[model samples]
Target: MMLYKLRLTFVLIAIGLNIGVQAQDFIPILKKRAYLNNSYQKLLKVTDTLKIAFIGGSITETNKGWRDQTMQWFASKYPNAKFKQINAGLSGTGSSLGVYRIDEHVLNHQPDLVFIEFAVNDYKASKHHILEAFEGMVLKIKKANPKTDICFIYTFSEAMLESYEKGFYPNSIIAMEEIASHYNISSVNFAPDIIQRIKNKTLAVIGPKQHPDSTYFSSDGVHPYENTGHLYYTQTLTKALDKLLNKGKRFNSKKDIYYSAQLEKAKMTHLETQMFNGIKAEIPPPKFSSLIQNIFALNQVEDLLQIQFKGDRIGFMDIIGPSSGTLKIKIDDQEPQYITRFDRFCSYERLHWFIIDGLAPDIQHSISISLAPNRIDKARILGKATDTEDYKKETWRVGKILMVDK
Candidate 1:
């Protein structure tokens, strides 16, 4: 009996050791490639503030998520280096929207190290739009400052697992990776890393903590719980950055031309309503509002507002809500185009880019917008209680205009 008991204990010990070894073998590690080599070196030699920009969807926008943790890691890593974290994340926006707003949201900050994460959000955007927006963003960053270092951080959502299980990266990842490779930009894909751990039976996909479940990592399978999700991101980023700090620049002189087409003509310029008319005219500011600011509200169908700027392409920086309405836009001697800001799934105050591109560059262009005679009483998904109270009768509101120059 004693011998049998001892043998059973020995077998259990062996099984545990084997499982531990398997888990260790599957431990996820990021690539050792260097990113923003010149900018990083400059940070090491200077005492000025090192601004690190985090731009992406909700994951990146969460102030407490990986953004802050990564910044903290940098602070501890470089005790003497001054670091400032710039949060340029807009929730529910993909790279296409990002390209249009990057100038106003991110480039204005002038960061030294920028992390662009849009793998999950870009899933809804077309491949063509993704390429143009992604490439446009990278090129714009380079154009803003050649020494600015950029890294494309690929994050995976729970829905993305199906494709990974089929031995394929998601479409968004595939599209963004192409651009990252062309630019020789450093990229880190954490999907496979997490997937590997799950397959190894060490990580849980869903369950209560008392049992075997890791649903706590991500509550809805897309947006991660700040603590768990952010930890995973920071771990991957800090590990890769630590490795990169010990390495030399990947390129002797980083090549500037990643793609042949510069996409420079796709730039956007923001013009406020004050540019069209003063504070007391055809457009009036909201009596009481919180979501939008410095906007010109129009209620009547005949209320016309015109803006003239020196650029080829122009777009409106406006938000949509339950009270939003349709508008007719005319650009530089062209027929009027009709646009609606209302949708079946519209409720939140989010920036919408209504743009008309492909105009003659270096020429003056005029744009006129007015409320369409027809109104849309959208079916409220969240009920009428959430409608914008002050602008219940307002049809169209112009927040700002964006013009692009070649």
Candidate 2:
């Protein structure tokens, strides 16, 4: 009887070891030698309260997602410490918008620790833009509170696994790592770990069964399901945190200055309305689904929202739904540029940025935007869809204007 019990225990231990080995086989422990020791020290010796903020896309935006899980872990680990967790995550937004709104959405609350996640969403942006936005966020946070600690976390989707399998880092991750290296900060990457599991055939990118019901890490290869994908992300983050705590090393700050002209201008710029077409039009919210808060609705073409502001860079965010239209944008005597928001791949309310950069930093600039006439039929078709609802007739809507001045 005793032998039988020992045998069962050994089997369980073996199974656990095998699973761990497979899960960690290809995972890169950390992007650099530096870890979040600054934040760890703060956590270990908190007198009053520690406020943490997470900035990311939909994955980190889920209510009980990894962000919440990490918060719970903190609560459990430090029972006496008061913790205030702020979720500044907006779905379908990359770091470009993040840099523009960090002051309003995150920095105002004054967070001691900030976790940034845009690996999945920033893929489409140019490397220069990604670097500028990422560096801007880090610099702004650290400048506001020198003691604040920031960490970059890379989240994966079905599209990114192939690159990891080939032992190459994705472009987004590479761009962020450059900033992380320059800032002497640390980054957590899960691509190798996930690829290991996929290679071992223990996990499927997409669930086999469909229609009635299905089991998958992600429903559509991008956003993870509420349970499975989020759990994996939480597990990865917690493990990294545990290691960071145990390392007992402090970050080496070189006191390097990271600066961008656009970022500096953005610090004191506002996008106020200088003029309108003198019409009050109630814009309906874009039909594209999203988890982001504060979306302005526009439903009429005749309703023109004209604004004039003094800034070097000026832009606005709008939805590109199935029935999305085009906008005629003119910046300070420049030729009017027509921007079409519709495409065959249009499904979600994507956040789009239209800005003219490199203008006289301190000069006052005026811009105008209005819906282009006869735009519905001219939209390029990229895919096929079926719907009883007239999703093709919805008007374009802008959320808010972003401006940056010297």
Candidate 3:
């Protein structure tokens, strides 16, 4: 009996130690907990369909990656809930273009929760642009539906590894965090945990070609391999979700009571409780108080789109597909310049934008964008001699026109 008791105690100790090590592996991924009450209520209590949207660059767009994995996990976790997943991810595009396209692709769906990842793509962008575009997206979503929950997701890249190793987020992520803080949104940063794993020699930043014996994260150090790196990302996300959901439970229990008490207190003083009562007001105007006048959606443009406007800066957004051709833009009598909609990235369809600034804002300017007739040198543009047949179709699809007045 004494030997059996000692054996049982040893087994219990072993189990406890193993559990502790497992718990340590789940590093905290949640950066903030702002207001997810509406999402919580809708996801847990409401029987109506739950809509979750993900918008980002290639990382979120790739198949069988973190995005899809998390969706599957959500379905499994909430077996009774009907989920509508909206994937608005476009490869090689940053928040600059995302802000312009969100309405047509994501907001129209009226998603209850949105996951936005752009850190890697926006790495090279100016801080000012990142701030304006990311905030614009946040404001647009809230304007469309105040109850919508927005979460910023930061993925990794080779260039970002150094910053993460130095215990700092990349500049783009820091700028985005400012917006998240102001708007009370949550963010999940995978960099810290990923860097730690790399440092521990457990997660390889590059594939076997670079590190044969190590478990690799990605081939290019940007896009995670579907199985290995994506699995880590998915695990981080689900762990964060678990923590958020637990907090939501506590919030759900007391939120109604807390709000009711505030309402009663407001009524006693004859004060308006609309703000406290969660009655959403009219959608607020665009928060961009800067030079950006407005973004006008031109939709699909096959041949030509000519417009007149007064603006110091001008740009346009379009889809770059296999068949996408170049655009000839003539602005206010200037020499017509040719901009190719097809690039090395055009092998697959993705969003691309071009901007021309430093023009005089005083005078009314006219801009005509028409399909270029000249045949492009695909071999020169793509840096390859094969698979240039797609350029033959000469397709042009313009999505939006961006105008900024001084």
Candidate 1 lDDT, tens digit per residue, 172-260? Answer: 76677667767767777666546665676665554443444443457567776565666776776776776555436553225555443
lDDT of 2 by residue, 1-406 (tens): 0011111010112321122211222224454446565566667676867889999988888798889988998899888778999888877789988887787778889887899999999876777888888988887787677777788999888777655554455678768877887777767765545555666666667773343443467767777655667777777777767666543444544455554535633542323333455543333354333323344444566656666566557777665666677777777898888877776656655556555677665767676677777645523364454352545565665666666643
- RMSD values, in order shown: 9.6, 8.7, 14.5
Model 3 misses residue 131 by how many Å? 0.4
The weakest ten consecutive residues by lDDT in model 3 span: 1-10
lDDT of 3 by residue, 1-406 (tens): 0010111010112321111111212313465446466666676764788789999998998889999999999889988888898988877889877776687678878998999999999998887778877867776676677667788998988887765544445788768877776666777877655766786798888875355578889998999987778888888778777656533412112121211111111000011112112222122123311112322221223345666767566676655667776677889889999987777766666556777767786888887777778767766777766355666667565435655422
lDDT-wise, the better of 1 and 3 is: 3
Q: What does the lDDT read for residue 208 in candidate 1?
A: 41
- Model 3 stretches astray by more than 4 angstroms: 1-28, 208-212, 246-304, 310-314, 321-326, 347-349, 357-364, 371-377, 386-406
Clashes of each: 1, 6, 0
Question: Which candidate achieves the best TM-score against the true structure?
Answer: 2
Q: What TM-score does prediction 3 earn?
A: 0.72
| Selected candidate, larger TM-score, 2 vs 3 | 2
User: Candidate 2: lDDT of 255?
Assistant: 55
